[model samples]
Target: MAREPLHLLKTVYGYDAFRGRQAEIIDHAIAGGNAFVLMPTGGGKSLCYQIPALCRPGMGLVVSPLIALMADQVAALRQAGVKAAALNSSLAPQERTAIWQAMEKGALDLLYVAPETLLRPAFLERLRAMRLSLIAIDEAHCLSQWGHDFRPEYRRLDCLADLFPDTPRMALTATADAPTRAEIVSHLKIGVENSFIAGFDRPNIRYAIAEKDAPRRQMLAFLEAHKGDSGIIYCLSKRKTEETAAFLNERGYTALAYHAGLDKAVRDANQTRFQREDGLVMVATIAFGMGIDKPDVRFVLHLDLPGSIEAYYQETGRAGRDGLPADALMLYGYEDIALRQRFIDESDAPEQRKRMERQKLDALLGLTETGQCRRQVLLNYFGESHAPCGNCDNCATPPEMFDGSIAAQKALSCIYRTGERFGQAYIVSVLLGAEDERISRFGHDRLSTYGIGKEHDARTWRSILRQLVAHGLVNVDLAGHGGLSISERGRDFLREKPALMLRIPARTGGRPAKAAPHEVARGIAPADRALFEALREKRLSIARAQNLPPYVIFHDKTLVEMAVVRPRDRRALEAISGVGHSKLERYGAAFLDVIARHSP
Candidate 1:
């Protein structure tokens, strides 16, 4: 095999070693083999194809969907002194001409284009005439109808097999379950034997989920620990994104709103600022964050429930891409579930697609209400078994499990006695013997199940009922007004009186202190914090001057390492993880100067 990949890895990217399966994947690509790669986000999937592209004899072609992602990757690649350019609608005519001329002369090592650009007959003919190194399809899951983010344009990508029959191709994605994987293989016409299934686990991210109680207050409490950190907050609606962004800004935080409803220029400007600035929180809907390559996102907070486990995983995976400690906090409630279910029920999709969506939503609910390690349940959904990770909220603070069998029996009985026509609020009220007009009209107050749940408070009952829905003991009627009905399993529980363990909801009140035990922060030492901040200011200054994202210059992890190590000169600084020959030559002295000034 060739030794150039390793040499390039050290000299160009400054990493001393190849990560898991990276060497094998790169070797396979260099040997002209096609494959499907199932690596998680931040798993260095790019290097698997990038290294081989450089080692091969011709220019590499990357097919991407997002213009911003293409621009970001090209900028980063050029920062490393590699010949990279992007051909997208955003480029000027002269710029496009320059890129085309460069491609024709083999002056560019890699060229990124939208799938539409690559599929154009003229562009395809030009590419056919060139000596192609390799073709890499990023976010390949979009090609699968079973995938969460399906685009019709991606379906046409299968034609690449006929167009470039001799070029090695690799389809890569971070979020794909078994069915999605099978669909990708069938759609791309790649062999299943060539698949590399890197296990889906982001240990650096701490997973936390709470039932929505005073959501804005809870969001504030969570943000307290992450002051001045870059993060994203996902909402379910455009109005909520605007309101939340305004709310956070009023509270003295730098926040921005993004949605498809906004003007294209305004949306692009907000996204550009979020990318170029540091410590800005972006509140947006699902329209944002598909191909965002920001690495230092300290947290990802979801104010509303995502549609499925795959959507949740893909969104939360945006955080901690630098492999540093980060947090993923999601606050969901019964209303969120009802809203999501109604969306699925109202969609124009076929019955089979709707059924698949229901199952996916059920899987998400199972994750939210599970008493086991949240990571374990999430991985299990993706067909991987993992031991309980101690990093999630459940593992960090084990919930108080009580025998909820009596509570379950009472709830099931109340739903049945009340004719299963009311939602959680009405059912809880009936169980608590509330004197409401609806209850009096229905004469539920006279039922045997009435007043039987007076021992537990309203909050406790709501928790129990929600868990029942999650456990499949209850079903919500999306076609109706979210009426609750007992499932067969719930009836069996009433007859057999099976023991059920349920978690007591945690108490919420008051603002938390600055640093909570579970809150993950940069692992910088107290003594080195000053130097770290100084280095960050320096990096940000340089980035602003160059109009590039701070991460493209150097990731936060590299800064933390530099702060701790206090690299004093060129040689010592070059030993840092991200300091390659190009960066060391261009940026080494400036960073060294900052470190020297902080010295005692």
Candidate 2:
């Protein structure tokens, strides 16, 4: 007798129910309905297609970008005791022949292939002869030219629609904005009504960003709080990534550098270490993490600014994929902002593209400098409405602010009084009486607002100028010698000094105890801490024996549920989510023994 999708969910995957849009998507695909899914990272997007593949006829085909990502998932799926295989360039010709035999013999349940492989006429012709259950395109945003991770091969994926018009096709991505979503829908020929747009909030992650003051020390202090945990520190350049990794290694953290410039063997080794080892940190550039599948990463720290909010969101989303509590911190400064601007200016991209990139950069900068709740700004960018998430730095510490109406008026007066031809530094210099050669040559030292703003320091004025630029009262003419020019809003502000407030993030001498891992376990009962640790210890033992990463055995979320419910036996363990039949038969009794030993 053929098992239903729900039965496979219970007996195979050991989940008692569907979360978010899982059941709907699975049923639609099983019944041959197309969909475009917009779910958050760590939100169980895999189940949407995995379950349908199990219930429907023929092999389920997944098209993905990275070979490493496909390999990780294939490992997990095989561990679940499913017949899955990947055919890629990495496999030898003979090994590929074995995969072909499995497909021909109907022994394979799912086949994961790359876009380049799928696009080959020989492969497509063979696929046409097979009874395909469905086709799923993972990280579907890569198909859009506007996306940061855009791949030219993904654009050819539209061929799937014409080749398999009747097969239920789905495209999935965690980082698609509205335009990208539309592009994906059009490209995949999937209807908007079939789209499932889930909430973008990763409430388990606590967000924090600090102005880069003593950057190395600040990063050291941050890393000190998360000692012996899996984290990734992102840098903009390859050289900076190596330097930061070496610095952390010198300071006693197990760290590795990963970048495009590294030797291929070195890159592969570092990535493997980051995945398999428990406490090693990877200091890498944007090239390091396109399809990272590690689930236990406890934190993601950025040493410099990211290119866009979408890029930032996607990079930080890589952390805490197991649904455990995690931390994401970023350190930004004026220099980082200036450096990013220079990149944009020097790019040979089209003028319109550069203009859009500038807007994206400005959006990220606003989020960094915002005085309001961070989560609100972050979610609203993805078109999700969220209340002030109390877990973020802004909601937790709530940056202090002062009435800046008078100060803003003075700053605007300084810009106008200096002929608006100068940039913020020069304007600020005239305001602070810097007595620079440029200032003296321009004779700006004799102006009325020259020394009137001397009450505030240069940094404070710079912050004010940033806020002005953020609010559109001031525009930095990037093309016209990078001078500061007053917009109509600045003129209106000068006409009527409306109330303006500025935020001041707290800066302490030493890193006060930031949010610890234990502190982040907000919803977990205090009593379950010991049990959770015991479960982790058990998982670690099993993982070590198998020589696999701990998450491949079971996620932290699954263990957390066990600790909460205190499942007594195999049946109870089956009731717990994430414990499939193979896993329950393999480890359920062992876990039950641990729970019994601890239970009073």
Candidate 3:
């Protein structure tokens, strides 16, 4: 087989070429090899399977966890003229029978089924009778018990590959750390030589961690800055999701709440609206959705802490899938840690499971408290080394560190004076020498350290408390009565390193400038703006007709470039960033016609 043929197929699909390790994985799969692909979201994982499905004979078997993902992917493939169909509980009996018939008749090139459907003995027997070109396990991390979203059904999928030893198999996921990766391989019985790990850096997403202050007020500021843009606000609880969505809706924004509590129809409808419409926000919890294929989410706001960094990364990965600039904002506080610990303690998981969950939780908390570049920390979590991105909040506004040895001593003294039985709010009150009923009842008013730190406000005292927790100088006893207690690190800090550097929280207040108009000519004359829109519309229409992603047809940046250069012919279009000789040959006439019609 000639490699040039794949390149020609690439051009026909309007993509420049395979991205990252896509071509390598595709080749391996096409040659009847097994692969375990650990690629992040927006890392071109789909191409690894999609290209092989297109190049090889027989239908590709895609086992997905979500029905919505199946539908979205099938729709995208169909739009590109690929004969794809999904068989899941959502399909009618007749429709399901027809799809299976189509599969047996070899009319469908790709078939997506839920894991439950794949586990059926009859279904497996039918699949055995068909010619399966390859098996692609999407969201492969779910196979591991250590994974945050462990599904029992995923573990059974290994039998599918077992029954079809001659077929190639590929497993892909957006988030998996070292242990999770190892567990996936062992659970699926995959060989190490077959795994392909793509670099897990999403450079386009700017990461920021905001100290939990008035969370609602902080969220408002963030939304105000990035108004009229699509985003997702993830809350830890369903009530919070409803409240946040309602609050945003009341504030004159298009916001919808989605959780498992709602009817399935409503959830599907809201998700569809969010993906198809512009500037719509979906406030959801972990129960709502995953593997959403929306490409233009501009931001992901975490109103509460996620249980693990993996969950956080995957949720935030939803933003900027189009490889454009976006934001990841996390609002965290001490209470979040307690909430997670409490939830973990109540779960029916085994001791090992609980231990792994705690470790994951600690990793998430470490990201919140670290003064290092947020992006670097996130990348490092996924086994990638990177210097400071110089784009996150920590890199942009470096914190001012102060020697808080004496302050740490004072705060520790207060906690001791109160018998280590108080939460953060009460501790702050005592540190500030506020006379409250709780303090009076506890006789904390007579302590020597009382009123010692009266000069600092409640905010300053709260910052000290947070730093104490972050440094492991103090620990919140989740199993006990939920109060702060001094740790051994605290004693060491007091005795050995008297001078500790503590970071001051970034101040929050300001109205960001409104986004410039979507029109290309922000400050240009109306005639030029009209011409730009005309050109863009023409490009989009051509993209649709050719069954390609809009950006592959001509990136938004390329359209902006065309607007500036007023490219008049094939030669000029070929000089554009994304348009090469093949693109110019195929698409030049249509774009040039638009420019000719619109040019003054």
lDDT digits (tens) for residues 1-600 of candidate 2: 144877877777777888888888888888899999888899889888888887888899999899989988988887787889998999999999999999998899999999999999999999899988889999999999877998999999998888999889989988888889999999888988889887788998989988765679888777777887889999999999999988888889999999999999999888988887878999999999987899988899998989999999999999888778788998876556766877888999899889988888878988987878999999988888888989888888888888878878888888888888788788888878886898888888888887878877777787777667756677676657767778898899889888987764355732323656543244678888788789988998998898777788888778888888998878888888889988987898889988988787
lDDT per residue for candidate 1 within 199-279, as digits (tens), equals 799998989888876789889988988888889999999999999999999999999999999999999999999898888
Q: What stretches of model 3 exceed 4 Å from their correct place?
A: 1-5, 8-12, 435-441, 475-483, 487-500, 509-598
Which TM-score value belongs to model 2? 0.89
lDDT, candidate 3, at 599: 85
Please write out the lDDT profile of model 3 over residues 1-600, one tens digit for every residue: 213426534433445667788778888888878888988788779878877876777789999999978877886666445679999998889999899889989999889988999999988987899998788899999988778788999999888657988878888898899888888777777788889998788887888887777888788877875676788999988889999999998999899999989898898788877765557899999875586887768888889888899999888999878677778888877767777877887899999989888788878878887778988888888889999998787787776677788889999988887888788888888888887987788788888877888866788788888878866688787676669988887878767767777766555422222222232244456666676677767765765675543544555556666767778877776666556555667678888888788787
Quantify all predictions' global Cα lDDT against the true fold.
0.88, 0.84, 0.78
Model 1 misplaced stretches (Cα beyond 4 Å): 1-3, 435-438, 477-482, 487-499, 509-521
Which of 1 and 2 is the better model by TM-score?
Answer: 1
Best by lDDT: 1
